[model samples]
Target: MHRSAETSLEDQAVDIRIQMIQLGWDTLTSVPKSRAGERSVTLDEATTRVLQEWRTRQNKERLAAGPDWNESGLVFTHPDGTGLRPSWVSEEFARIAARAGLPPIRLHDLRHGAASLSLAAGVDVKVVSAELGHSTTAFTQDTYQSVFPRVAREAAEATAGLLSGDAARQA
Candidate 1:
């Protein structure tokens, strides 16, 4: 519930929306390191539900604050019910990342990380690309190629039984 005083109203509102939706709002709103994320990775269904619930809660707050609850269209609204700005959202993303001891990567790195993590988990590249909002499969593959080695290594480890597993078990 504690917020920085310097925090802009715009960001505060956005934070509220994110909180309400329970989505990885910070991840979805920020641009991605890869071009694909800038294009896609919108709030998933579960997060969408959180947003809907927050929206209802916000509506009640609006009604309590004023009679113009009907005009409150956006999920995140100011005390007077205005839309949140983009810069504020970005600033907060940076602040949170810094606090978390994360590397000083762009806010969008989450998209790439998500892709890398998914690929590592054996999710298909096509799915990763789509989730990352990649325009072409090749681009997705190119950007995430670094993951292939790890992917291969993980696969080998997971199926160690082919050779290593057999030898180890016999011993």
Candidate 2:
């Protein structure tokens, strides 16, 4: 989701309005790839507080930049308020992850992880699919859902428990 520079901190939701795509040397902002991509994502309280602090810091940078500030209306930007290139973000994420001793993972892997984790945490698939901007829950389940061993075992146990309860009730 893209946050506008003018977005009020009072609201903890960001609308997914625009997408930035890189072509050659230029980065262009345009409508999202699909209609489903246009949605709102609500921030948790902790994330909302962090963004509030980041905005304060960014405002200070904007003041320091003076006439040089680009006014790009992005939540994250360079000191001069210009947007960062997507490729640069991905490469930097890799470097940071390596420095933190994490297993080598592409930045996009986080999306898959979020989907899988959300499912494992018992969040509804439809809600997770919507957050991911997937057109359909079937596609989301087919593509992003990974059945972890523990989650699989928990599911089996829960089903057996339900069956046991049914037998007891009948008796």
Candidate 3:
């Protein structure tokens, strides 16, 4: 089960408890699209520190808003603590990416990049699949994981070394 954002932040993790979707004129909070989507993602040290700073800033915003604060209990929110629209967030991301001179990419492409990087870094496919909330490793591999040229070359070299008994000698 997912804990409150406050509690999860203390643990340096973000629990995927709910999803917020904008439907035409209304915004709705609902369960995730799949069972696997309701999982926890642990943060690295830098990310945890950044979130801690953001939380402190958010608290100040809440105090400034006083009675006007919405208390949505979400990690990301507007100055008055209301949820941001998903479409707006995507548009903002695109603008930010463009300002950085990055090639055009949808915000969702970050997930694919993360998955590919994890696989290239030698993380187990099952673990990467779980992190991505993928139903199966095969789907994760087929859709997100790419054989980075460096990683493929390393695998080829390792296989050749093993066949020539050079791997044992190196070990």
What range of 10 consecutive residues in model 3 has the weakest lDDT sum?
1-10
- Write candidate 2's Cα lDDT for 1-171 as tens digits: 265743556788778888887787788888988999888776678988998898899999999999999988898899999999988888899999999999999988998998899988888999999988989999989998889999999999987887896866976
Reference-based lDDT, residue 83, model 1: 49
Candidate 1 TM-score, C-alpha based: 0.56
Compare the candidates by lDDT and give the number of the best one.
Answer: 2
lDDT of each: 0.57, 0.86, 0.83
Q: Number of the top candidate by TM-score?
A: 3
CA shift of 115, model 3, Å: 0.8
- Candidate 3, residues 117-166: lDDT per residue as tens digits? 98999899999988888889999999987888999999998788887866
* TM-score, one value per model: 0.56, 0.89, 0.90
Candidate 2 error regions (>4 Å): 5-9, 163-171
